[model samples]
Target: MRQLILLCSLPLLVGCATTKTGLAPEDVSAASAKGDDVIWTDAASVEAQCNAALEAGRAVRDTIVRESASDQDVIRGFDNLSLAIDETYGWTQLMFSVHPDKVIREAAQGCEKSLSKFLNDVSLDRALYEAAGGVDGEQLEGLAKRVHEHQMRDFRRSGVSKNEETRARLAELHAEMVELGQSFQKNVLADVRSVKITDAGRLNGLPQDFIDAHAPDDDGTITLTTNYPDFFPIQTYAQDSALRKDLYEQFMQRAYPANGEVLLSLLKKRHEYATLLGYPSWAAYVTEDKMIGSAEATDAFIGQIASIARPRMEADLKLLLKRKQQDDPKADAIQVWDRFYYVGKVREADFGFDSRTVRPYFPYEQVRTGILDLYGELFGLRFVQDKDADVWHESVEAFDVYTGEQHVARFFLDMHPREGKYQHAAMFPIQTGLEDGRMPIAALVCNFPDPSKGDGKALMEHKQVVTYFHEFGHLIHHLLATRGDYVKLAGINVEWDFVEAPSQILEEWAWDTDVLQRFAKHVDTGEPIPAEMVKKMRDAEEFGLGANVMRQVFYTAYSFYLHHRDPTSLVLDDYTDEIFRDFSPYPRFDGSYVYANFGHLIGYSAIYYTYQWSLAISKDLFTRFQSAGLLDPVVAKHYRESILEPGGTRDAADLVRTFLERESNLDAYKKWLTE
Candidate 1:
């Protein structure tokens, strides 16, 4: 997942030449340039820093709205406002997810709420709207023109033209929604559920390293948390049905009782916010600016994909049921807990491949280095570790990206699990790059196996390697795409529905035999993975495609419908179960509350369908690679220039058309699903 913290759209309200804070102009410029003053250890400093930025941003806003302001002045002012946001609210938002100190995280969350309210108030400012609207579009060219146009559009969509009373109510609703979103996310981060196993024998099918990592305590019990490092192995390899079921349910119910009302409140507030703007529902308002264009179009797309996936999903279920019958002849249906185990069984028995056989070749450190080398070779870039750089954690690694001698960007990898850290994998942008010499900074926050523990060999599942590639895709996209002058058009600031395409397309490299052999050497023998084994691995990979696509469809529908209609009489738990039964191949578990822990509901809102929509675009994009050869530098360079370097300066459809020399369609995506 690519986690986007709002930075560019919010305008400042007050117009003043002097800032209230005592900090000098040079101090503010240096702080934004270095990108190192992000971490906040004390709660008070978070508030102080945010207040200072707000003062500076107000001054910029004031200058933009002045009578003597020119087109160039307006553009610079908006860029300066973006700088203020990156220095303050943007950094704090990242800290809220990755910071080690709980007190600091909570403080950052509070600052974020304050910033959100400020943004809401300013977004409704009539003067700011009029000033932005007054920009001469004919005077601006290229990205400058696009930036001016987008700013005006955002102002209108933010209810800048509404009456004072209505705008005031919208501001209150915006603040409440932000508060509820933070509460919902915080509950999931704090609630790390675990199950203890009294009998060690039940851990039979799990890998030796996993068992070694969780050695029993003096009380003779092994405890497992719902973290990815613990949860996924149990789901795929654990032999005990009862144990898997217990862990599965516990994992699904992560932030249950706490987030239940929080989600409901969020949905209700969002619906009201949309209706106030004259939209029927939140989904309708949110999708209007996206590539999908409208809620009805989004619904039709979901239906089309679901229909295409249903046949494959049913066939995959039959395979799983047949595998399950060998163990329990009376078994009539596969349980949710049974899906992973049986899929692995079918792959090993029918496809002549076992996932465990590939783990020894994917120790965490080797895979990390291999990925960097592979991408560097393909893209004509270099990565050097920055040992002197400050990091939030000792385990975090920082690096500088360069194209030949010119430094292009910086990134960090925090790729292990800890208490209170974000549980899933995501790319968090820390700083937006600008042509004015500020380099983009990003961080990949993931929960992969730690090489420091368990005999010093953190052998990753192949799927984890794929996830690493997917996330690094996002990191590079952020770095490579932000060479433009405007922060609003920088990084992955493309349309919401198209943001995942670059990342999803990169997942293809993870499965390539030529690519894997470069890094996937055995932990003990140091020999490259066998080509025949890679072939079998690829074959097994296709086995569960139908079921997987349907699962995504189910999530997309759930996210959409939750905001697509009135929530005044909706019940979160009941609605979740109902959606599951309607779209999912597997029956919903009796007591499961999956929605409570679904963090995407908070960040992604009604646009979870973006994943699949972008996947279709990605598949179409990959055809050029398929013909030109995956590692062809000419093709890669063309792709970088045509598809990525423009960032959000051009419409996403135009970028795709430029790269492929034609409009993108679903032909490639349909082939991928049915073949």
Candidate 2:
């Protein structure tokens, strides 16, 4: 999913050099209408034009800062800056999308590397934050000041204050990391897609739909692809124990090729970069701006969750083992591949709730409406469908997000799967806004099963429902940002860890009876989810939670350990695998090279813990609405004012404090996990 999110900006290269004649936003819109001829992909022309535009934007931005300007002027200047940056970013991204070859990818990374220096020149702290302990009054207003502080901490943590030599070194390391990251991903995508099975009997335990989907010709066999949708179900359901073991080993070996070297290089560059910036490790560098302050804090938090979860996980395994025993009196011990399949079966037998029963009620359009209905009820905002939107894809839909009469922003919803498009759920900020008379536009990019699968019905599994709501949370944050004169202040241009809370909180909507009742209508029957079924759903909420939670903790811990620990002290081959050992009961699989494929360490660095940390905050924050009704507009409006609209315009911690009337507590998360 993360890999696909990286491709959303590829369309920016589709347009011509942005008209340099100081076109107004209206003029830009008029120009964009002549669309297909815009030629930003010419490598030579794009670089020269982009540099010129960036220089002009910088001068305008500086003037805004230096003049002690009027509110309106600052707003206008910020909007202009946003427009300039957006053009450059979009142009370069288009090239990468069309040509993801090594050369094109490198050039795109280089463009980003170059543009970053100009756009982020001013320290985020001095520009927006009050408590930055630097110069004062540079931030635009109360809201701007809050955003500045948040931005400032992020810059500081990212080593913006390093001396020129170290900064240069860090930049070089970043470029290398980008190259390696791309390489790592390309390898995994190819490796995962390359796996094949030649025997028909191998499909023995697999579902009829899966086997039918992948059936081979003359060979009388079915070949499996390593996509999560394909890989996970086979692991869980395949009756052939030997086949499961073979698949598990094959799956784990995804990083086995030159990926070990890739991981080592990435680790080395990260460590050197962190050390150059006076941080003890990359974890410290990354986590400084996150919810958890250090690697130690994260490990401690993981330990706290693990203490309760491990025991429950043991109990879960016992239940699964008993079920397997009933099948065959002399059955051997259950292994990793058997876990999901047996657990899912046990869930149906014990709790009587499974995804197949729930999926029919969640047609694509109804789920989307449910999301809007949930947000409208909670946030006092509405989304009106706009069929005339300038969408890049035919399957994509657009909407105008509104707060009463004011059109807050525009959102493009690309919900179905396609060739050349990314295959996951993610939010992309197509354009971020500013108080300076500019509005942001965002895209919710999701790869739901293609329409052909169910005769054009957008039937979604429960997991997909959660994913939809989650991505929409991010869209809400981006569209609702009413902060500074700059686009960066408008949306998720904040700390990574804090970013997930908004999205994760919305996932709770999928579980709520009150919320689900409004949107969960059967596509053919038009009936609501049964109350008894909802009860069963709630009763089974914590099912497999132990395994799920542990999986996240492993990823988070691996993220921290990889970035923060001293790479020189350990053998690079064992780096990523070693991190998983303490968290999981099993030892590391020798053949798989996970770090080679772990791309989050590229964009997120040491900050993958954001998901877990945000989950904690989400659990606590949603408790407020849980106490009220999920749709209680009064509390919803309060959330909009305190959290959603603020964007990066305020400290995430302070925002939570103000909204919840105190610091967010861990008790709620701990209880949720234990239950």
lDDT of the candidates, in the order given: 0.81, 0.65
Predicted structure with the largest lDDT when compared to the true one? 1
lDDT of 1: 0.81
lDDT tens per residue, model 1, 52-132: 777777777788789898878776676666666654665676788889999889988887766655555566668777777
- The TM-score obtained by model 1 is 0.85
Question: Judged by lDDT against the true structure, how good is candidate 2?
Answer: 0.65
Worst 10 residues of 1 by lDDT: 11-20
TM-score, candidate 2, is 0.82
**Candidate 2 residues 1-675, lDDT tens each?**
110021212231111111111112432453332221223434666567567656766666565566466654544544455556664564445333333244554566577656655554533323422223343536556654553444455566545666667667766787797788788777777877434667777778667887778778676556666668777877778877667666777776776667877877887887888778778887876666555767788767767766756766666667777888887678655566677777777887899876588888887877877788777767777789898664455676778877788777777777776655555566766555556546667677777765656687868887788788778888888777757655445566555567778877877877878678888987789988887887787676567676667666777777777776788766755665567667763346556556656666655667667667777888899889889878787888888889888776666888899889998888887777676
Model 2 lDDT-worst window of ten? 13-22
**TM-scores of all predicted structures:** 0.85, 0.82
